[model samples]
Target: MFKQIVFLKRNRIRKKSKLVKQVLLLSFDFTSLFYTLLVIGYFVIAIVMEGNIRNNIQDKIISIEAYTVEQFWVILTAIPIIYIIRSFNQPGVIFSTAEYTLTFLPNTLQQVWRVVAIERWIKSGITYLIGGIIIYILSPTSASIVLLYIFILIGLNVLMTLPEWKLFQQHLWLKIVVLISLILINLVNLYLKSSFLSILFIAILFLINVLLLPRTFQQIDWKKVTAASDFKIWNMVMISYVTKIKYRKERQYSIWQRLSFWKKPFLYKKSVGYNRLWHLYFEKNIGVCLKLIGALFLLLFLILFIKEELFFLAIAFTIHSSSTVAASLFNDRLRTDLVQMLPWDLTLFKQTILKWIYSTSALLLLPIIMFIFRDLSVWTLIHVLAMIFSFLFLMPIKIEKVFKKFDNKASDFKWTEIFCYILILLIIISNIYLEFLIGVCLMMGIIPILKKAEK
Candidate 1:
């Protein structure tokens, strides 16, 4: 039974690896593929011409100082911290079909649980070990630093798995506190003197966490955890897209309860017509809108207060917002059967979309007011207006077409969607006025398609 389970796991891994490679190869169009090969070829020629890559790399690395050791730890620590925080709500640990297969196998429940915990620890340790090794090479310091890296890695793995124990799963504040404490402990370790006692303390902490593993496993609501982690709809859909394997949930699961924060009363007293429609959707999915708004606001703040020249990058962000907002707006609507049941006017739908897109694009204008308040240039004004027009006039058509694709139950993403933005980027970098003309013409061409799709 163990051998069979191992074989199944290996097979699944191989299939997933093959599927990812195929999707990547197919995702590249001629233009992207050519550039990709060109870049690879250029790098290959450069490396061949350089004679000895290892020696060159060694020469480059010789100038580094011990201060960089601190920086290395910061970079390595920041990534997993962010990842754990982001996924705090969801414990995405997956075990194989051991629950079902257990009945037929000789392995007891405790044995299976131990196997799961050991497997998880090994996986986590491998990831941390790789990162620690790279950092050790990059910023060699006291031998104690190596020990510190090892302890930090194991400590994080323990902290991350604490959710499985159900101690902090539902307690948001408690989770935050524990995470902060773990971080503080790691930081303090960096300053500690190199000693056998310090190393032993780290080892003891790790062992205690290890000792807690069996209880963690026993305490877990295995059925619930497995159900939630095993067959997420989005994960299945993504894998199916790449692999052409229609993976479905083994057991039925209901949607999670809607968040209560957005359940406030409608914006207006008498919610009628479009007001009602917008309120219903927006209130239910306000988180998406808020996230996008916050990101754009941050960009605006940075460009205005911190660095003015970052406005160039801000323009790209503003352009990207069209796609982001469009996705958020259409995600639920396309799946909603009631939308098709209504006597919806095609023209009204288009106008409503245009209104929303324009309103969203207006947020991008806030940064330009800073320029106007200080010392404004005609070119800045022109560039801003052209981008606004592109978002208002051109982006809606692209968004509407995206809606049509969704309505038709086609693929969720397309290569052309990416290439279109690439084209616009090149044109904008060359000349804004020319981009405006091109945007106008593209809008004209897409209008008929939008109308047809809407109907």
Candidate 2:
């Protein structure tokens, strides 16, 4: 019976592999190929440059190494958490036709659950292993520490699939316990100053996780687990480059529906009108902005108190953020069906959006500026305002035009977009008044362009 189950599971994996290959071929395009090569080139360059990049001011004032280890880890941890939250909110799970065929097999439920748990562990191991490799390359941590971390993560991943265990999710106390345990382990390892003891502790934890799994597996809620997991698999398959294919857009939640009355203030406002609608849209999705702003604040705090060498990078990030918020003002509003129904005068609409973008940018910028730049001159202030206003007016139009060109294609990072972002950063830093004038003139061109596009 076990042999049959193993054979069926292997067969399922092979089938999935074949399906993934077909999907990849179907989604392949010259543009996607171009972007893929560009990303590969970028990583190659980054790897080559990594050693030369300096954190200290004497090494090179404006190098990428200006970002500290703590900053990098914060950014890294935030991304997975955000992605997980997004996945949960917009589940795209679909029931597979192949699952019906599995019913003929004996003890199908038990076999299926175990197979799934193993598959999840393998997937998590791959992810953690890649992260470990990146850390090994980038950090000064000893190989032992890196290996221990990776091994512990993999063991924890397996433990998470224990039939009744909920992982570090859905249970606040479990999450706290896990977090505290990790902290204590690290603290003990730091104090002990013995690598052997550290390994021993890690092994003990791994054993505990392994021993608990059988009991947890017996208590597992298969139906609930499968229902949640199926959506995750479907979503991953649809978005993955190895299995990219168009899927129906996930249902979107209204801002009100997503946030309770107490929590809604971060993403809600009392306002009405076409002119005010853009701001309302921004408010509705302000959580993303808040997160970005919080990160920028952290960057600024680090630059001021810890490492002033990252000043250029901080400015670059600020400008990049401004451009992103500006771009969002159009992307969401343009896609919204109700935008057409609004009593929009194109001239007024352009002015309103431009102002809205500038306000959002300033909201993000002022604190950073006040905190970081102590010797702020009027000229510097004017230059910053002029540069941001230019970006506020120009970036959305450029993004809208470019996005329209690739509207049919999957939205993935492209080098062309990166170049545009680099251009925005350069424009901000150049401090050339005539360049700002040119940008203003470019804004005039987009007005008529947007007018025609809207019509």
Candidate 3:
């Protein structure tokens, strides 16, 4: 059975289609030896640093540090529960018939317990090792205690994963009820300042999940599982999935048109039809716009309610939006082969791109305005205007310059990508300085240069 499992995993990797192979190859190449070196170097540095800290730090300071370490471990444990639940909804990267066969196995409870046990052992062992090292480094006096706590915590985390797994197998309403109950439990624990109890509760839930797993497995069909096709059904159930498919189709169509030399020039002319630029833009990109809007709203909602630390969450959202906008511009640049073929004058093409950038910038600004401002004020207005102007004017020029420089390369990253990096840094710093005017002026300067580049 073990050999069969191993063979299945190996076949999944080996028999991947050309596109999948390409994606895996690209990811591997991009990461390369740096990943191995990075892991080794991090462990070495951590060990050395820990030794130095243990030798030098005072006892009182070490005690304080240990509390921080414990808190960090608790947060890390909680975060991955959400991630594991999220991963189940994602399609499996590795194909496996064994997963199907598991449903048919006799002694389902024993088999399920074995799977859960092995998973917990591996997970808990790693967590214990890391926590042990941390405790030894920071508070060697509590090393053994920390190791025991870590074991408990790891067991708890594994237990928590089980209930969440079972909850995910339910109807949408039932799943929502489970989620709400869990959230209420967490909230009450937080209100009472009960971290250890929270961990314990999570652990209890995992035990329940284990109890339920065999039944869940029994309910699943083994023989017909491999033949199942439900992407369409899933799409119908998940609005987000539907939106994603629409976005993907539109993106693919745009990419195809942009890659076709014969069709490019004529299609470029069609882009400006009826002088109805807004309609054209929406027709081509509303799916992407809606996606961004959804993301922004979701992020703002999380920042307001979900995360305890609002400041970092706010900054993260801003940075995420800015980076996404910059990346989209880069993608647009990659489609420049079609742009070059456009019958429209080069200057006109530049103008149209500038207009598109402005429109997108406006759309992006709506989220920031809604999230960051409590009421309408001159300062808020100024900040909003400055941000919009900067993104509209400066972002396009920077994108154009970067794209021109890296036009020959098909890779995701190039030296020219640094322009967007610098732009993000500037935006962050400008926000810090509260110098809205500086940003506005900087953006204004880019227009003339962009025009000159068009020529």
Candidate 4:
């Protein structure tokens, strides 16, 4: 029976292995390993040239206190990243035959113990090897000292996982309580002076984690566990990609159609001249602006609430703004085609784009202003007025000339777009540093130029 179970599990693994390979092909660049090697090579070259400069800085700033703090920070930061990577890989075990073998085996407890032992061994071995390499590189210490530290770090990481693992499978409230307690302890540790007592407290926490591991392992429903693990892997690989594709398609259509709806209230009949032109523009690209507005608001809410981290907020904003801007440019490519067909000159195109920009910006900014301040401030009122003037007068003329002169295609990373993005970054940073008025003025100035360029 045991042998048959093992054989079936092996067959399952062979089937899933092919699926995993397909997932890898779809999800990641095949040349990622080559790219990683190239990046490592560059890092090594940079380190070789700059190592002396770093050494000099270290020499100047060297202190036992600083060194200790730095070491602690490195260890603390590493623990989470390592833990996540380890967890990501371990989901593979759920898809394996061992789970089934354990389920059908007469000595269920014994089979579970065997699986637990093997898992612990693999986890510990991999953690130690990686941790040792990192420590050796960073400190260039003797193997004995590195090995000692590696064991300590690995024990700490594994222990950290136990309470969470147990809680994840059992009572969620208990897990939350434990998590809160751990966070509180970390906070206390941060604010309080280092002492033997504090160290002892931390050691006890580690001990509790280690004690929970066997219990956590014993709680696992082997059959359910195997199925869940397989489902998780497949869900991540197939479901996530499919969901993303569906979301993109929906977003594109929603944005485009929403904008077009306003222009053509009654769609059945053919229109003429300016009406026809307006209809064509509306049908072709109105969705682009609507999409941008939706996206901007989405980002605003996400940054304002979802992520408290400043770095992530900055990254999100950059990506959100740049992609939206690129989409706007791509939409403009169709407008360029319309421009060739229209009796109106390039100036008319510039005016049309400026009007679109002004209307869209007004729609986008109103919600933000309303949300941030219940009553509009005098400065904000003036800023809005300035933006209107700039969009109508300054931006249209300047942007149209630039676009006509350059005639550059939209790309993932165009130099022109990069410059615009840098300007946007500067504006955001300036908003952080300067008065709101200055930031408003800077934004107002850019609007006209952007509008003109669309022409």
Highest-scoring model, lDDT: 1
Q: What is the lDDT of every predicted structure here?
A: 0.56, 0.51, 0.49, 0.50
What is the C-alpha local distance difference test score of candidate 2? 0.51
Per-residue accuracy of model 3 over 252-314 as CA lDDT, tens digit each:
233223333525334435446412333344446657765766576557545645542352235
lDDT score of residue 379 within candidate 2: 49
At residue 243, give the lDDT of candidate 1.
67
Report the lDDT tens digits of candidate 1 across residue range 87-156.
4444534544544466467876666655555666777788877866775675534446666767666666
> Which residue runs does candidate 4 get wrong by more than 4 Å?
1-17, 20-98, 107-110, 134-145, 157-162, 193-198, 206-228, 231-455
Task: Please state the error at residue 68 of candidate 4 in Å.
Answer: 5.3
In the range 44-150, model 4's lDDT, one tens digit per residue, is 99987977865554454445324644555334433543443334224323333455455565756546545544565567779789866765555535667567666
Model 2 lDDT at residue 314: 66
TM-score of 3: 0.40
- Model 1 TM-score, all chains together: 0.45
Q: Which stretches of candidate 2 lie over 4 Å from their true place?
A: 1-8, 20-115, 122-150, 158-228, 231-244, 247-307, 310-313, 316-336, 344-455
> Model 4 scores what on Cα lDDT?
0.50
Worst 10 residues of 4 by lDDT: 246-255
lDDT of 2 by residue, 1-455 (tens): 45654575588678767776677667778688999999999998997677554333224422333443323333322222332333332221211333424656665655655554565677778998898777666655556756776775665444333312434123333443454455444434443455565556546646766786556445443444444444444454444644345443334444444345524434432232455576567667678776776687567656754655455456666666656666665666766767746544444554566666556455445444643355477645554554454445345554545354335443323433444454455444444444554554454445444544443
